[model samples]
Target: MFISAKNIFKNYGSTQALSDISFEVNKNELFGFIGPDGAGKTTLFRILTTLLLADKGSATINGWDVVNDFKTIRNNVGYMPGRFSLYQDLSVEENLTFFATIFGTTIEENYDLIRDIYVQIEPFKKRLAGKLSGGMKQKLALSCALIHAPELLVLDEPTTGVDAVSRKEFWEMLRNLRDKGITIIVSTPYMDEASLCDRVALMQNGKIMQIDTPQHIVGEFPRKLYAVRSSNMYSLKDDLLHFPEQHSVHLFGQYLHFTAREREADILGLRHYLEGKNHQNIIIEAIEPGIEDCFIELMTENSASNEN
Candidate 1:
């Protein structure tokens, strides 16, 4: 195993940050922690990277305990935190060189590992980190993280504030890195990125709701769902929520995804009900569930259980 976390728990005063969290990652695998903000992704990443202690449970990286063998783990793992923590006054090239130097290495020693990502920002080598664009800064940060050529890489929301194009490019770089035999553990609030990972752990409210391949997780959605759209999406959603049969109602992009109280839904009856409500150009059809859909269902279930 490249990474192992068992029954981890963390709290901050009155707030519970993580609850009995447990998971593992195989060598060279791209594992993702998929969740919205405050789902304990950053907290877990911190504990796994030996930057913080968990109040309960244990974890190991590359056979070294995260707490007792923090030095070894630090040497073996590369971490890029949620916030951009590089020296903003330094240039891109300067930042990379500085990070490499700290690890007792030179950029020339591991240029191949980060060449692809670094080249994208190389033209801005002279630009101060603070003056670079968000995407450029991210690229430089990733390059710094890889200069040490560690066995494992841990990134926390590396794409949070970047552009769409940069985010896509970043994932491609991660894939290329994984192909070179470096295991990766990344956390993202973007549900779409879940598919890019070999496996993902969906988290909510400090607990893991599900952990499996993206396909398997989405395949496990327990109810028939439909994408419904009308001339007035807002009113249509409110009306559906008010309907006695609706089990779940969530807005998905320009449409509303809804499920019924019964396992099997009455499409004709639903259409008729909408027509009676003066909804125009109504479109309601069964569609495949997505990661976001599954997360929402899981969150609803978690809340219901807590309430009960």
Candidate 2:
């Protein structure tokens, strides 16, 4: 394992941040840690990057213990935090130089490692870090982090708050980086990004719900799903939920996604029931599951199982 975390735990003044969080990343794998805000993603990233120590359990990067070998781990991994932490007063070139110096290296020593990304923003090398656009800033931040040519890159929500175009470009850059054989472990709140990774660990609260390739996760949804839409969507949702054959129902895009209690759910009966309630323009069709659908199903099933 290029990265290994075993039963890690951390707490704030009163609230628990991470609880027995454990996972591993293989060499050169594009592994993603996915969850919503306050899902303990930052806390776990901090622990793995050796900026904070866990209260219990252990973690290692490339066989170097995070706590005992902090210096080595620091030297071997590139980290882009959730927040933009580069020096605002410094120009792009200066920031890159500073990070390289801290790692006892120079840009000339590892120029090839970052050359592809750095060249895109080299024209803005003289611009102050704070003055760059969101996409430019992300590219510069990644350039600085990679100037040291580390084997692993740990990014904590690097795309949050950026525009959609920037987010798309950022993921494209990540795909190129992964092609260069650098192990990457990134955390993101965007469920759509899950499919971009070789594997993902779905997280909620502070625990991991499932770990698998995106296809595998979506392939495991047990029940038949349908995408339902009607002219009176508001009333249609209410009527569908009240039906006795429903396993689950939730809004998805302009349609409602639902699982039927029986595989043989009567669509005609459902449409008639809504029509009797004055709902119109009913459309219900079986739809293939996506990552978001699988994630919701997993969390719902886990919660129900725990209650039982």
Highest lDDT scorer: 1
The per-model lDDT (C-alpha) reads 0.94, 0.90
How does model 2 fare in lDDT?
Answer: 0.90
Q: How big is the RMSD of model 2?
A: 1.4
Candidate 2 wrongly placed segments (more than 4 Å):
none
Clashing pairs in 1: none
Predicted structure 2, TM vs. truth: 0.96
Stretches of candidate 1 exceeding 4 Å from the true structure: none
Clashes of 2: 0
lDDT of 1 by residue, 1-308 (tens): 88889999999998999999999999999999999999999999999999999999999998899999999989878999999989999998899999999999999999999989988998889989999989888889899999999999999999999999999999999999999999999999999999999999999879998999999999999999999999998799889998778999999889999999997689999999999999999999899999999999999998998899
User: TM-score of each candidate?
Assistant: 0.98, 0.96
Give per-residue CA lDDT, model 2, range 28-85, as digits (tens).
Answer: 8999998988889999999989899899989999999999999998888999998899
Task: Pick out the ten consecutive residues of candidate 2 with the lowest summed lDDT.
Answer: 263-272
